[model samples]
Target: MKARRQRLILEIIRQQVIETQEELAEALRAAGFPVTQATVSRDIRELGLVKVPGEGNIFRYAAPGETPPLRRDERLKRLLRSSVQFMDFSENLVVVKTLPGEAQGVASAIDQASWPEVIGTVAGDDTILVIVKPKKLVTTVLQRLNELARG
Candidate 1:
């Protein structure tokens, strides 16, 4: 029931600008989920939601923004930087090691960067295995990741 309500609330927020818990509560009720304000509050926290620009003093929630971390670009600047301990590539796979717990965020930043060489990335606690297209892209991928770490 909780997951159902939360999904409905998230869908509502994603589709429209939802302000206050009161508004969310009403939306939930409309969606046939009897939800309390406290439930909505907890859901917001659990979802890692943030309020972005909206109408008037009413704040709207959204999944955390993907606009790269502050003070740098998405790849080397945002995620790698000092946190990246090592990086290397073999064939079409690039391995990146970060200071534990940072790999996921760094990898997420890379995924959000929308690079052409990147087919996709698999991230662990402090490591990421980035898969590139056409094995030859290894050098280019490594160079791009290295540039990102520059920040």
Candidate 2:
């Protein structure tokens, strides 16, 4: 039951912008899942859904890792071009500097990218610490980021 409902949740979110738990629950009920708000919330957490800015001031849920690859790449490239001031690396880490208050947005974009080379990221007000998977891949990731920033 949980698996089927979770699958429906993914399907619904992919089909339209679901902005709230109530909205999701309603969608599930309409789909015949008849889920409660608490159950929907738990499913959201378990599915690792993250809220991304949607139209207007609203936010919509997204399964970060499941975003279409081409769209994800384009979004990441656009994000880097717009917000990344400069980037540098040492060993297995890459530090990205962004305009003030922009690091978090850029970092979130990177996280949503699900890049194999990236372990994770930590963002401050204007700085982001990116942990690369393999130490040798730091240069590769840096180069890719630079290319993305350039284009």
Clashes of each: 4, 0
Off by over 4 Å in 2: 1-66
Residues 1-151, candidate 2: write the lDDT tens digits.
9999999888888888888999999988988887888899899999999887665557788887655444677778888998889899988999999999999999988888888889899999999999998898999989988998998
Question: Please, what is the TM-score per model?
Answer: 0.51, 0.56
**Evaluated with TM-score, which candidate comes out highest?**
2
CA lDDT of every candidate? 0.76, 0.88
Q: Give the Cα-based TM-score of candidate 2 against the true structure.
A: 0.56
Instruction: For residues 40-127, write the lDDT of model 1, one tens digit per residue.
Output: 8899888877876554445577678723222235234745776899998888899999998898888777777677778888998988
Residue 48 local lDDT, model 1: 79
- Give the clashing residue pairs of candidate 2, or none: none
Candidate RMSDs in order: 9.1, 8.2
